[model samples]
Target chain A: MWSRRTLRQREELIAYLLVSPWVIGFLAFILGPMLTSLGLSFTETDLFTLEFIGFENYTKLLSFDATRTLFWTTLYNTAYYVFLSIPLTISVGFFIAILLNQNISAQPTYRVVYYLPAVIPGIAASLLWLWLFQPEFGLINWALSLFGIEGPRWLFDRKTAKMALVIMSVWGAGSNMLIFLAGLQGIPTELYEAATIDGAGIWRRFRNITIPMISPTLFFVVVTQIIWSSQVFTNVYVMTEGKGGPANATMMMVLYLYRVAFREYRMGYASAYAWIFFLILLVFTLILFRSSKAWVYYETEIGGQRS
Target chain B: MSGAAIGVGTARTSVKRARRTQVFLIHTLLIAGGIIVMIPLAWMLSTSLKPPHQITKFPPIWIPDPFVWSNYVRAVTIFPVSFLVFVRNSMYMSLMITLGTVLSNAIVAFAFARLSFRGSRVLFFIVLSTMMLPQQVTMIPLFILFSRIGWINSYNPLIVPHFFANAYFVFLLRQFYTTIPRELDDAARIDGCGVIGLFLRILLPLSKPALGITAIFAFTWSWNEFLGPLIYLSRMETYPLAIALSFLRAAHGVLWSELMVVSFIAMLPPVLLFFVAQKHYIQGIVITGVKG
Candidate 1:
């Protein structure tokens, strides 16, 4: 049908055709919703009617009065979770990766055991942990008894709820371990050999050769974990029975936004909450990206091509 | 000379002994860590088989003395909506979404990777940047959009968005496509294979591992998704396994054994996938840094 058209034009047309679905979806799903959400933030609605509320929703959420809203509590709770979970999970994952990177027998079997928990569906894992964390009869407390230490009320106690979640998140650090392991394996063995010949001990070789080489991987894990963990909802929702409670101790921003939007049907208020949450995430990600240059080492830079 | 050689030999043997001890210590630590990691899962299995009497005991039973295999049956049939319905709903949605994800991502990625059209670079950058936008920002509007279109309680809302191609998968596939040599495309075109022909015959056929990775990621993502199903499907009958398993606790009063049985059932597909196609699964995960 396009025989008369030049080959280049035909190629361009075909390219557009191939990509149109994604472009259309991006506009319809992502861009359009983003704009509509922004518009919705300015108006109060309940799915039936809309009233222009201006910036009331934002101000209410960001207000100093913690009594009027649970926004601060949710933010604080989420921050607590994010800040604590990231470093712990990263360190644990990196440590495991270093262990697995050693030339050892039954390596694949060890890897499978570690990665198994990471693949369990979130809901199932949450359910499993809920049972495991039962204060009286749970295996955790039972094990604690064996060590002659009394176990604290985990998810049931507000003071320990966030800590319980941090512990659970660390269990699923197998993927991070795998990523770090890949990075570890990628380090040329010759570097370690040369260092050893120069009388560099294990710690010296690890610091000088290993750490710099995998700095990029470490940076990647941190960034992704930040973005992902900040939106943590399923585990908290399922375990806490969608309440984030034991005095709202585990109430994350997304869960709070969910309640406001779906439960209360406070569309405008929820949209505002959503936007605020988005900006906070954006700031964190931006800061991480900016800071990455100082730490994230790339071999390509020395090769004179910055990819 | 003999005395010096003997000294060197002694030093070498001592070094080897130290290395052996190091390996032994590493193995010991690995075993200890592995047991710690496996405990939760082992307990889940134990809990699923335990009788009601054994479940709430002070010291948790490591093994169920009277193993109640009937918990699985009770779990499935005791619910108002049978667990089978939830399984069917989950499988249908997961399969459809996986199909959509694989097909859409591969085609769009092909365009960006193989064709050097005007503005493709800019468009791909937009695709990548979208990854940073949190889902919560769009959640409300999307809920409104789907509700306005009368799509709630149906699989349409859960499955349709995947057909458009997600940015992360597109980026992954595009990366995969570029690693294939351009010479094949050139040779195909010289033989009068058009653009579509090249993609189908030359590219798609050879991109099995990449596509397999994409399919596995999509299937697992769909299988394990919680928030989407939670928001979209409100009715018990329409609920996927994730939603259904969560509700089991709320609806049934501490039916721990039954709940475990259902949770185990819900976890089976993805866990089995990981076991069966572990290399591809791990590769897919590592490639995109996507995790459960």
Candidate 2:
């Protein structure tokens, strides 16, 4: 005959058991490694040996020419990819979303058409693009010649490698387009009708009503896309064959960090690099959230102050 | 009055004409966009069937003259090991990850959604935080951990973390589970259902749609996952489709025909599965989009 106290305790125990998978995972995988990585960043550790080097890894990343160059170039490449792709993706995705959300016949078919490329595995897409980007006898160049416009050597050209990646990103923007479409559908028709009564053209309704209504989603897409695309790997790895050449022009931060850890075995240095990237991503994310206050419209100001 | 009637007729005619033009223009633009997006895929299928002689020709063969059905066979057999191993490995990984993620996430999500325990809010927020946490930092250390555990060159590294429940999926499921009314959970408890019984019978049975979404997303992610498999599964036998496909092009000079054929094959499952479950797929994307 258990007492009520023991029964309540049993319930609590069950609750803890229910959540333990995630809690244990958080401890074992996320929190544990995060702290370990942080600790290791300061200490240079070969597998068999460990020494507390005291900011040597961090200092070298900033001070050494080769390390700094690698770090900066990768960061720059990542920034370029993110900056170019996010706006292009959001804009084009928004445009396509609007088109599909209309009273068009066969909207799902068109959505599927646009979305098909997105579902294709990234590596497969990269390979297909690799063939298409072949300087001579490539489909893109061949198609370009038909229009009498000399095509730039896309992936092969250092000047255009990142651009090629941006172009690739634009093609796969359909997934985001679906998201924007979802946001668009969630907008009430009454609001639009009211806008129509208040004297608005198509472009005006879109710019003022649609854009503001979807701004929160826009913020979401922008932040997440920037975060994800900054870590773009498979494309770089597959297209450039893990070399990040010609002359490391396409080397992004993640790739560089991977090479550092696995290829060079600079575990401490790579951890340091990883933490820096993490902080940068975190800062960017925070900045986005802060700036979102200006542009992101909320229906009820969820989790924020009501004006 | 007659002139006014004639003006109205003209106005109506012009409006009809304008609307027709608008419809035509929308289709045209959509069709054009569709074609642009499909060119790579269309070109892939076309290239895969072309004879080797026509592959690199300046006047590229737009369509294969003799449809070489044998190219698919060649692609599978050309690799040092049977290409089937990679496909099998990838299929197993994707299936396991999907099941593990769906099952575990549903359990954890039930805990978060129903249990009003101390620190539940904080714990739920931690789950939310992990969804957006930068993985690069933990990647190396995790790799080290896995290697020390003798999981390197095996499927454990790729498959085990997912069994712990993906943070994104947990939040997604948690949102879904909350909609199933607290009354049901309470009634189940009164009916002698324990927490596990409540989850298995009341929650999960009703959460099939959410589970479906989780499964689909996890499958696609696991299938396309390049970097994880690339890092952990160094052995040729353990290589998944992504790594194996990457190696195919790198090894033996660029075999365009075989590469294209294999790529087309590699692409079939997700594309087909996507089409089959596209409604759920779209909902998954939308919910994730709105939620995030």
Candidate 3:
């Protein structure tokens, strides 16, 4: 029979062994590359060739190229997409959640219907949107014509491509809606009852009680939406073929990085671009987290503190 | 007092009338939103059925005059022999990834939730932090690593990484496992079950919903994954449905009918999975916010 100390040591070792797979994968697949990419940003080397010139890539990215236009435009598009989509999605989701939160008929069926688009694969959804936004034979235009309004050349026109993406983004607002619904349910029923007793109207009660109570969740959604929107490559890739086109209207940063890295085979330069994107996201997320304390209400003040 | 009571009654009656009106308005808005959401899907279905000329017809045909079931068959037959291979590859890889993710994540989560392991919290945080790193940063280096291991152009690269716990899934399962009382494990241990046996027998059985959620996520992600397969699998035979469908689009440009059929077929598995596993998916989301 082993001593208690020995047995404890053995258990620790076993535990370490069990988690080793994840630890190893994290180091190799995630950490190693993260560090390497950081280093590579300062160097000029084709990743395959490995002939490195120091500090050239970063200097070039910062000082030399007119590609700053691409960077800024992409940043503007991404910011616009996030800023527009998040509020719209959150509000729409919350509105729907509020309606569904009530005593409604066939609520589960309605929930499922709203949630369906969230489950559809991105590629399929983008492709479906492609057909829907087709200039001549598209159903969207057909519907527009019925209302006696001319439809814009959506995908083909630079003016409307980003708007089309924003519209597409709203289609999958169901996931956020579900989260808001859960948050709604978690708000204490007593609070609402007390508000009602104090002569609060529905809208007033919602503003004072519902909004503050669910602010944490709203913060969560906002942060995630910003992160995800900034990394918007797939929709742009599928819709615009990485051209960002009709004159680079929808050319997002991530899509541009993908093209430069894979298509143009400029790995080191793309690494710098990736780092810039990461810094931008990191700064924004930090700002949101810093500001969240002012607005986000917790059931227990100490209970909801998450790093 | 008499005047105040009478005024209150009128106000209450008007409020009731307003509530009824609001309910009607809400339902109307929801129905309209639902229709708007459904239109693109409807258009896809309609386009898939329409004849060649009708596909690009102005004012878009809402319904096809002649319903064509042959588009699906034509789509299948027109693609390269490798299309079938891609489908097979996708199925096998996705299944493996799901199984591996579920098992590994459950194990790691059990350790985190139940076992008094040293460095567990720190390790878990490390896992969480990894999620913040954009995947693009690691793409090339991981590609190099896999190439070095001779895992490139193979499903091993696609599926093997999943055998190690993913941060999100592990965090999810850990939360789920924590909710399962420690008493269950203690009772099993009192009955002379070993640690591994307690986990497998007691915890695993109770954590089916979590498992289902992880499995569904793994399956769907693997199914819809384009970048991984595109980067690693150069050979057509190793391509998955997403890559294969993209190829079909490129090769048969303007064959909208056939492309629609292919897209619909490609969409089937995830949609069916979502319908089947909707409960756990929603539950997974709710629990994470609480236990996260």
| DockQ score for model 2 | 0.38
Question: Which docking class does model 3 fall in?
Answer: acceptable
DockQ of each: 0.42, 0.38, 0.33
* Model 2 regions lying over 4 Å from their true place: A1-8, A67-69, A301-307, B1-17, B290-292
lDDT of 2 by residue, B1-292 (tens): 1111111112233447777788688888889999999989988999899888889988688889899889889889987888989999999999999988987888888888887678888988888877678788889889989988899898988888888887889878887787788899889988988778888899899999889988888898889888888888878999889889999878943888888888888888999988998877777766566321
By lDDT, the best candidate is 1
DockQ of 1: 0.42
The segments of candidate 1 whose C-alpha lies over 4 angstroms from its true place after superposition are: A1-5, A303-307, B1-15, B289-292
Q: Write down the worst ten-residue block by lDDT for model 2 chain B.
A: B1-10
Model 1: TM-score, first chain? 0.95
Tens-digit lDDT track for model 3 on B44-102?
88888888888888866678989988887888888667457767988998999999999
Give all candidates' CA lDDT scores: 0.87, 0.84, 0.79
> What is the alpha-carbon lDDT for the whole of candidate 2?
0.84
lDDT of 1 by residue, A58-174 (tens): 888889898878999999999999999999888988898788777666777777888888778999999888888889888889999999999999999999999999999988888
Indicate which candidate wins on DockQ: 1
Tens digits of per-residue lDDT for model 3 on A1-307? 7688987887777778778778877887788888888877766656456657777776676663565436767777888778888887778888888887665565666677788887776777877887788888777788889999999999899889888888888888887888877777777778999999999998888888888888988988887778776788767787776588878888888888878777777777888888888888889888988998888887678754431
Best-to-worst DockQ order: 1, 2, 3
* Candidate 2 structure quality by residue, lDDT tens digits, A248-294: 88999999988988888888889999999999999999998998888
Worst 10 residues of 3 chain A by lDDT: A61-70
